[model samples]
Target: MLPAEFDYAAPASLDEALALLAGGTNIRILAGGQSLLPTLKLRLDRPDLVVDLRKVPELSYIREEDGEIAIGALTTYADLVASDLIDSGVARCLAEAAASVGDLQVRNLGTIGGSLSHADPAADIPAAALALDASLVARSEEGDRTISAGDFFHGLWATALKPSELLREIRFRMPANGGGAYEKLRQAASGFALVGAAAVAEMDGGTIEAMRVALTGVSSGPFRLHALEDRLVGETLSEELVREACDKAGEAIESPLSDAHASAEYRVAMAGVTARRAILRAAGQWR
Candidate 1:
């Protein structure tokens, strides 16, 4: 499990990190080393240089701003779980998803930014981010750009982040009055999502006002249940309606990944099941 010999740089500041990245694509950014180390051990990623960001103290905070929550790219899963910001509302789904990542060890070591940037279809964070309609902040020598969570994901193990850029932070508007849930069918060994779903909904007098449903592990990337969410608006919460909407949960998947752990069909089926569970729980607390 030894990685190939490569040059390593642990930059002390974001500017230094950006400078190194500007040098070339052969340089990989290391945040938490949670995903990068595994890829290196597998020899799946070959890089001439590895730039570590752990030493950069600036990119590791979670705070509130103007009715929104700003999450640093370096924030770990354990941080998400412990933050008071996640006790209720839309952020609750993110907290639950973070809590379900691997075990306590992985949660302690894994950064939310690394997990999202890795763009693993089976990973938990992206689904919750999508459900919350978060935006990603990416910085480079050229300038800074804010990308919507919907626009950040491209495909399996892919993201819109340019090689010369570093993801600086993630931001989402705080929900005023709402409820949400994250439900997953977990793989036995890895604890990664076999099929996971996150739902956030707001109610206006027992009728659905705004809602989002995003699914992971059944698609090439996390995505919202657009049609289902649209159908839910103005509709009163009902078991039949919830089931009917969630039945189309896997329809957005373009190309699904299948392995020994679970087949594509099983993932698709469980996506529907978990989505139903998530939306039902979200609906339950809307009152």
Candidate 2:
């Protein structure tokens, strides 16, 4: 089906885009058109105006500054996969997640900002964002504000972004020492994750100094396994300890999603399976 009739504007500057957003109600910002176009075609969202940011060349970039990697809102998944800077540690988790998104076409066009803003429960990036301890910058007519990844996603398809705000950039700090990995079970048809997990582990000698484990596609929103992380910190790194802690992976999920692709019970079980694999891989324990 064709998209509903709407006014369109391709703004070359972010300020211009912000001005357009501030002046209109029922406005949608278009980055890569990966998510929004399909929604528009389905009439799931009919807006008064669609502000396309494709012409805003400044918003598409990847750079590192002051110990953090800053990714522009319009940076494509393909860009992430190709960047040499994102090859290790927490950043690698984000890169791996990007590599796993849909197919080549989607990866080529889908923006990281667009994926996070859409906040789809089955999206691959949110889990990595959570594991990497990312901070998202939201731009509005008023100014810019940074929101932690933990506080960003409110629920299924819902986020902290105000209607007038656009996600401007995503930031991830370089870990002092650690490795990270993303693991997922994809649905056969859509390539959307059935259950995805991202894990980062910082080791001090043989002890686990700190660790983070997050899950997506199993709950209303991607979330960290804080309890599991808390249990592993300061403990001696061992296959047994990581495996045992991961067994409680689904314990914190109060409402696991149930759908035709997989049952709630199956998701709950796979949560542990994916979490274990991700944690082991991040810790360099996986063979």
The digit string of per-residue lDDT tens for model 1 on 65-88 reads 999889999999999999988757
| lDDT, residue 60, model 1 | 95
The sequence of per-residue lDDT tens digits that candidate 2 reaches over residues 60-160 is 89999998999999999999999988877768888889999999999999999999999999999999999988999999999999999999999889999
CA lDDT of each candidate?
0.88, 0.92
After superposition on all CA atoms, what RMSD does each candidate show versus the true structure? 1.7, 0.9
Instruction: Give per-candidate clash totals.
Output: 0, 0
Q: Predict model 1's lDDT versus the native.
A: 0.88
Candidate No. with top TM-score: 2
For candidate 1, the clash count comes to 0
Residue 225, candidate 1: alpha-carbon lDDT? 84
Please state the error at residue 117 of candidate 2 in Å. Answer: 0.2
Give all TM-scores, in the order shown.
0.95, 0.98
Pairs with backbone N, CA or C atoms under 3 Å apart (clashes), candidate 1: none
